[model samples]
Target: MRLSDVWPVRGVELRHGVLELRPMTEPDLPTILDRLPDDLEMDPTLPRYAALDPGVGRAVALVQGYWRAMGGWSPQDWALPFVVRLAGEVVGAQVLEGPHDYGAERVVDSSSWLVQQRRGQGLGTLMRAAVLELAFGHLGAVAAISSAYLENAASLGVSRRLGYADTHTSVLEHNGRQLQHLRLERDAWHGSGRGRAVTVRGVGPALPWFGLDGERA
Candidate 1:
């Protein structure tokens, strides 16, 4: 059987204007690893633990983890990982992860990153909106949550633009230093006007993977 028939979420795709979000496939990994800049710097506002190092080895390891996660996914505990492409070129990634009872809990956590050159052009907002669309619109998520270090203004801005509100704050020790974490949440997302332009494809086959097929009826 085809992979999509076995794990239908693999077939899903989300798109808005020039930006596209789709499950990361093995074929897409090498291009992402090669095109990601060697000098790429992590956002200073993020905790050190959340940062991406600038090195070929680090990138390779990252992709290896991604592959492992995809291979091991189950309906009970899965990560809906997508590669963000702009006009057909790989530029970044967005991931929505959930626990063993995701379908019933209806909450998902998200993380994302874009290449430095693509940071300030509203692409981040668009990319995030697309995923939020998938989370709430397709997967029946009641709330989406994310975290950023207090110093990460860009990430905070995108959350705000997309209707996420500050939920709480905490501190964590990372790299021998304490970093502030700002939790954000959107509990009432209904694919609001923010991502109205975003369109999801391949969802029909994927709904069963997320246990949302009955709801779709």
Candidate 2:
């Protein structure tokens, strides 16, 4: 996949009947504020203060800054976030992050979350798959990665469905406890080759539309 196309970074949307991700708007703020996930608070893996760490702290802060800059969050760089929708209702946000224009060839890392109401319905797997489509299909991302709390079976479960193999584990603190972390790489994803086929159209206006060989469209 080509990885240089600069997306709108404003109001991008990924759609599939019943399952979709749209940009955040003022009206959506209520839903966003109302439905944000508190996984870190409930997970045993997170440290009592993992959220304070520079990496995790920066990650969350950057999301806030980006949201404020756009006056709301949609999909954009470093933290390309989205409002995951199901049957026209807001459910969560899917994020693509890590270094953009990473290294020479370009790579991306994905992260995502859905409100408590949407969990256990298999929506998490679909949402991450949707993020992959954005990264590999339109963004021309040469490769990708994903990470999750190791003990968070549900999150890891989604990775498994999307073909992410276990990389290694690290320990960190979140809300107020220690949590194990797991990493996933693109090579393992390809080797597994098990995620559902996700396709997108009608995104021309949101993207710079790079050509097949990765030159300008």
Candidate 3:
């Protein structure tokens, strides 16, 4: 049987034109490791996958982390580490995570990366939009949150383009770097018309895993 038959999360897929976002399968791991963006000196405060040093160690940690997420999945806390593909070629990764008490809070957070050569093509924005669609349009999220180092213009740009407003700014004590936080409410998401054309498949069976009773949009 296909893994998706037992693990519904593996069946989830988000598509917007040439870009697609889906759970990273075991077979995709090696290719993703090879295509990870060259060191951009990611912020130490970012998610472990994004902050790790590139090479064998980071690759191994990522593989283990992927398994841990799957094994630890629950309604209260879960993460979808999505492998991003642009025109059928691996580009990077995007993750959507729900915190403890997620059912009560109805909020979700997202993080992502794109290889150096893909930076200027706007794929980052498109991929992010696709995930937000899953969060707000399907998963019943009341708000979607994102953060980026103050110096990372590309990420902040993607956030703004998707109607996320500046929520706060804080310093990461670990690195003393300023971090910009942004949020997009469901109404604002629908109003922005971003990801309007994005289509989702295989999410129906995954709703319960996301702690939702049924699809919202």
Best by lDDT: 3
RMSD to native, candidate 3: 3.0
lDDT ranking from best candidate downward: 3, 1, 2
Q: Which scores better on lDDT, 1 or 3?
A: 3
Query: Model 1 — which ten-residue stretch has the worst lDDT?
Result: 175-184
Query: Model 3 clash tally?
Result: 0
Q: Could you give candidate 3's per-residue lDDT for residues 104-149 as a string of tens digits?
A: 8989998788888888988988888898888888888899999988
* Regions of candidate 2 where Cα sits further than 4 Å from its true position: 1-7, 40-65, 68-77, 98-105, 173-196, 205-217
Q: Per-prediction TM-score, please?
A: 0.83, 0.67, 0.89
User: Tens-digit lDDT track for model 1 on 57-127?
Assistant: 55755576586567766666677778999988788888888655876777777778788788799988888
- The CA lDDT of each predicted structure is 0.72, 0.58, 0.83
Candidate 3: where is the Cα deviation over 4 Å?
A: 40-54, 215-217
Candidate 2, residues 29-66, lDDT tens digits: the string is 55665565555332232233454854454345434544
